[model samples]
Target: MKILITGSTGQLSQALQTALAGEGKVLALGHKVMDLTKPMQIRQQVRLLRPDLIINAAAYTAVDPAQGDRDQAYAVNAIGPEVLAEEAAALGVPLIHYSTDYVFDGRKPEPYHEEDEPRPLSIYGASKLAGEQAIQAVGGQHLILRTSWVYSLHGRNFLLTMQRLLQERDTLSVVDDEVGAPTWAGTIAAVTADMVRKWRTGTGGPSGLYHLTATGETSWYGFACSIAQNLERQGLLRARLEPILSADYPTAAERPLNSRLNCARLQRDWGMVLPDWEAALHQCLGNANAHQANHSMQATQSL
Candidate 1:
């Protein structure tokens, strides 16, 4: 099957590319090749590629900046998927889109199920919710995967940010109120590939919105503490970690206090299971260390 993946350079898309390498002909399109903000460009590219499947991983992810950039955010996160769904419907192809757990207001005390009513509190969440709605309105073959706190070894994510900050600073403060799973991009990509393969083989269940995230939950402060502990074990710098409330670190957008998503439906239907946040983090950091060691060896050999 020929697959077209948007946001090629992004963390999730990069993982998808690697995961889907043996699936079929994969055409990776970055912003330079296909800008999500431009509907006409999206239409033209989809027409040109005529791919069997289109996985939209591109999104306007600047939550704080989105408060002042609603238009751009909607253009990419909302209108882009709408246009993609329309094109997919026209071509009779399935479209796989990614959404966010931010769609919830975080008022719920328990984990959010797939059927939970979304009450977005911030502009970014609203835009992403709009995207999900727009795709459903198009009435096409689509699978909307709502994930949370996605990070990877690559990309500008909280993990890398903490790693850098821990090395550069003596003390670090993280919000302890906001709770969610720190999902690894590679895990999402691998599961996506499995779902796609099952679909192709006519074994995958019906398509709809499903929550895909790590097994457990943690606050930003807890996540940072875990990262710091691992880094210190690896002979990295040790920094004093401080836990603070969300209000202590103000931002343009209001984040949800609870971002936990229930993955029961995904597991029941697709038979997909992801590692816990802590396990995934350990593997990710281990891979990073291996990569660095290989690079250093290559450099020394060249000298």
Candidate 2:
């Protein structure tokens, strides 16, 4: 089955590309190839690809920047998916998309279920929720997976930020008040591929919203410290780190206090279990190490 993935260069898209390479045909398009900002571009691309499934991995993910750039965010996160869903509906294809845990105000005491009514805390969350509404409104075969605190080998994410800061600075402070699962993009991508493949088969079940995240939870402080510990174990520690609350690390946007998502529904329906956040973080750091090694090797080869 031919699958078309938008946001080809993003972390999740990169993971999906690597995971789905041998399984089936994946047409992963970047901004240059399929600019989602333009609705006509999405419509034309969907028509041309004629894919069985269109996984929209692209998003306007500048959470803080989104506070000031509502138009750009709405175009990419809200209206862009609306256009994609319309075109996919026209072509009779399943649309798989990603949402965020930010949709909730983070005031909930327990893990958020798929049925929980979304009350977005910030503009980014509001925009993503809007996109989710659009996909659902289309009434097509769609799977909207809401994930949180995503990190990967090839992206501007928390893990990378911690690693970079650890390399450059002598001391660091991270927010501990905010909590959520540090989900790995690779895990999300792999599970997505499995879901899509099942859909292709006769056994694939209904399409709806689900939460896909790592097994456990941690704060930015704990997550960063774990990375630091791992780096120390690897003899690469270079920075001193301190744990602080969300108030210490102020941002333009207000972060949810509890970003945990309940994946029981997803696991029960899809028969999948994601790794723990700590394990996922280790893997991301490992990937970063591998990437650095590759770059060094290429430089040596050129010399």
Candidate 3:
């Protein structure tokens, strides 16, 4: 099958490329190739590609900056998916889109299920929620997978940010009040590929909103501490970690304190379960170490 995936250079897209390797023809388009903010461009590309499946990973993800730039966020995160759904309905193909856990107000004591009401706190979250609703309104076969605290080594994410700060500073502070699973991009990509494969084979269950995240949850401070401990074990760096409340570090956007999502529905329907956040983190760090070693060997060969 021919597949069209947006956000070509993003961490999730890169992982999707790897996961979908040899499965089918994948037309990966980045912002340079197809800007989500431009509906005509999106419509044109969909018409031209005429893909059997559309996986929209592209999004405007700047939480704080989104407060000042709601137009851009809504254009990419809301209008983009709406246009894609309309085109997909026209072509009679399924579209896979991603949402965020930020849609919730974080008031619930337990993990959020798909049926939970969404009350987004930040403009970024609101825009994403709007995209989900827009896609549903188009009356197309689509899957809106809601994930939380996603990070990976290949892109601008929490894991990479922690790595950089650990190297640069002897001390670091991270928010402890907010909690969520630090999902790996690779995990999302793999599960997405599985879903698409099953759907193509007429085995995939159904299309709807599902919470896709790691099995366990942790605060930003805990996540940073884990990364620091892992890096230190690899002889990378040693640093003093400090945990602070969310108010201690204010931002333009209000973040949800409880970003945890329950994935029981995903597992029941897809017959798949993701590893814990810590295990995924270990695998990511291992990959990073291997990449560094390869680079070092290449340098030595050049010398």
Candidate 4:
């Protein structure tokens, strides 16, 4: 299977590349090669590549910046996917897209299911929801995976941010009110590859939305603390951290208080199971440490 991964440089795309290394012929396209802001670029790229499967990992994820720059967000996150879906439908190729937990208002006391009605609170969420709608309306084979609190070893994510704060400051405060899963890109990518393999041999692709996230849940503050604990175990951090509320840490975009996603339906359909968040974090941090060690070794060799 010739698989095309968009947002080539993103954490998830990178992980997908690594996970699907021996699975198939993988082609990665980042913003530079295939700009989502320009729909024509996407259409042309798909025409040129003629890939069997396209995984749209690219999205405008700047939550706060999206408040003021809604046009750019809509262009990339909303209209861009719609263009890709149209192109994919034209070519009869399957599209695998990613959405967010932010599509919900986070008011429910339980984890959000795939059937839950989306009530996006921010422009970013609204744009992503629009993209999801477009993919459904395109009448093509597509797998829409909605995840939350994405983090990886080598990305600008909540885990890395907390690690930096711990290194730079003596104390840190994180929002405790918000709750979600700290999903690893590696897991999501692996599951995606599995799905691709199955789709290749199976009768047909599951053409609808699914929630793929780590098992268990945590607040932003809980997530930060877990990162600190893991780093401390690795002898990488030594700072005091405290938990606060969302009201204390204000942002232009309103975040959902409950971002947890139920993956039962996904498990039943895909036969994929997600590991616990802390285990995922530990593995990711170990990867980060290993990468740093390799880089340091290369620097010493050069010296």
Candidate 5:
């Protein structure tokens, strides 16, 4: 089977590329190759590639900046997915897309379920929600996976930012009220590959939106502290982090305080569950370390 994955260089796309490589012929495309903002280009690419499955790993992820740039965000997030859904439905293929916990307003204290009505708090969230609804409206064979707090060893994420700043700065402050699971990109990709295999074997559940995230939750401050502890253990710690409230740090866009998502439905249907946030983080760092060691060994061999 030929699998086409968008956002070739993105964090999740990178993970998906590695995970799905063994399952089929993976064709990953970057913005230069297939810009999500162009509907004609998407349609043309899909027609040309004629992939067995289309996994849209692309997204407009700038949360705060999206407030002032709604048009661009919608072009990539809302309209792009809508066109992809239409094309996938036309081709009679499945399209696996990723959404976010930001679709909610963060008012509810409990975890957001798949059935919960989304009330987005920012332009980015609204655009994502729009994309989800558009795909659903198309009545296509689609699986919209809603994830939260996605981070990886690569990419611009909270994990990398905190890691660098925690060593460079003498002190730092992170929000304590906003809470969610810090999902690892590798975890998402591995789980997605499992689901794809189940689908191929005719054991997968129905196509619909599902919450796929790490089991546990934590605040930004807590997550930062975890990273700090890891660095300190490696003798790289330098920052004295402080916990601050959300109100203390105002941004152009509002964020959902309760970004937690419930994953029981996914587990019940697909028998898919991810490791806890801490364990996933450990695995990411371990992979990075292993990768670096291998590169060093290769260099020494060449020498």
Candidate 6:
């Protein structure tokens, strides 16, 4: 299988590259090489590469900035995805595109499911929701995987941000009210590889939307505390954590308070289940390269 993964520099894409290393001839494309905003360029690349599978990991993820930059957000998130779906359908290939939990308004008491009606609360969320709908409308062989609170050992994420702040500041405040699972990029990549393996064996399920996240849930403050606890064990942490509500610190983009998504359907359909958030975090931190990467990031931030 010739796998084409977009967003080469992103955390999840990088992890996917590693996970799918031996599975096929993987061609990961970065923004400079494959800009999602340009439909013509996307078509050109898809036609040229003629990949057997296209995994669209690219997205406009700047939640707050998206409020003022709606056009660019939609261009990349909505329009671009629609084009990709069309192209993938034209090629008669599967397009594994990643969506977000932000598609919901977070009003429901329970976890969001695939059948839940999305009511996005921000431009970024709305854009991503549009992309999901567009792809579905295209009626192509696509897996719209909605994930939440994605982090990794490398790249910019809550984990890396907390790691640096916890080391530098005497005190740090994180939102406690907004809750979701902190999913590791590594876990997502591995699960994706598993799905690809199943597909190769001709035992995959029907193409549709699905939720893929860590098993357990936690608030941003809770996630930070866990990061601290893990770092403290390694003598690399120092900070007094403070919990605050979402209202305490507002942003341009309204985020979903309840980011938790029920993964029972995914497991039932695909026989896939993720590890708990804490265990995944522990496993991610256990990587020796993580320490070096964290130090490098912190140093870069200081300079």
Q: For each candidate, what TM-score against the reference?
A: 0.98, 0.94, 0.97, 0.95, 0.97, 0.95
The digit string of per-residue lDDT tens for model 1 on 1-303 reads: 889999989999999999999999999999888999888999999999999999999999999999999999999999999999999999999999999999999999999998999999999999999999999999889999999999998889999999999988889999999999999998899899999999999999788999999888899999999889888877887679999999999998999999999999999998997899999988888899899889999999999
Q: Can you write out model 3's per-residue Cα lDDT over 53-161, one digit (the tens) per residue?
A: 9999999999999999999999999999999999999999999999999999998999999999999999999999999999999987999999999898888999898
Give per-residue lDDT, candidate 4, residue 93.
91
Name model 5 segments beyond 4 Å from true. Answer: 294-303
Q: Between which residue pairs do clashes occur in model 6?
A: none
RMSD of each: 1.0, 2.0, 1.1, 1.8, 1.2, 3.9
lDDT of 4 by residue, 1-303 (tens): 788899988999999999888877899998988999898889899999999988999889999999999999999998989999998999999999999999999999999999999999999999999999988998788989999999887668988888888988888988999999999999899888888878888943467899999999888888898888877877878679988989988999999999999999888877887899889888887887788889999999999
Measured with C-alpha atoms, the lDDT of residue 42 in candidate 2 is: 85
Go through the candidates in order and give each one's C-alpha lDDT: 0.94, 0.88, 0.93, 0.90, 0.95, 0.92
Backbone clashes in candidate 2 total: 0
Q: Candidate 3, TM-score vs. the true structure?
A: 0.97
Tens-digit lDDT track of model 2 for 176-283: 888899999998988987887677775666788999999988888888889888778878789998888888788998889999999998888878778888887777
What TM-score does structure 2 among the candidates reach?
0.94
lDDT (Cα) of model 5:
0.95
Instruction: Please give the ranking of all candidate structures by lDDT, highest first, separated by commas.
Output: 5, 1, 3, 6, 4, 2
Q: After superposition, how far is residue 5 of candidate 5 from its true place, in Å?
A: 0.5
Residue clash pairs of candidate 5: none
List where candidate 2 sits over 4 angstroms from the true fold. Answer: 287-303
Question: Clashing pairs in model 3?
Answer: none
Output the lDDT of residue 54, model 1: 96
| Superposed Cα deviation of residue 170, candidate 4 (Å) | 1.0
lDDT of 5 at 17: 96
Worst 10 residues of 5 by lDDT: 284-293
What's the C-alpha lDDT at position 220 in model 2? 86
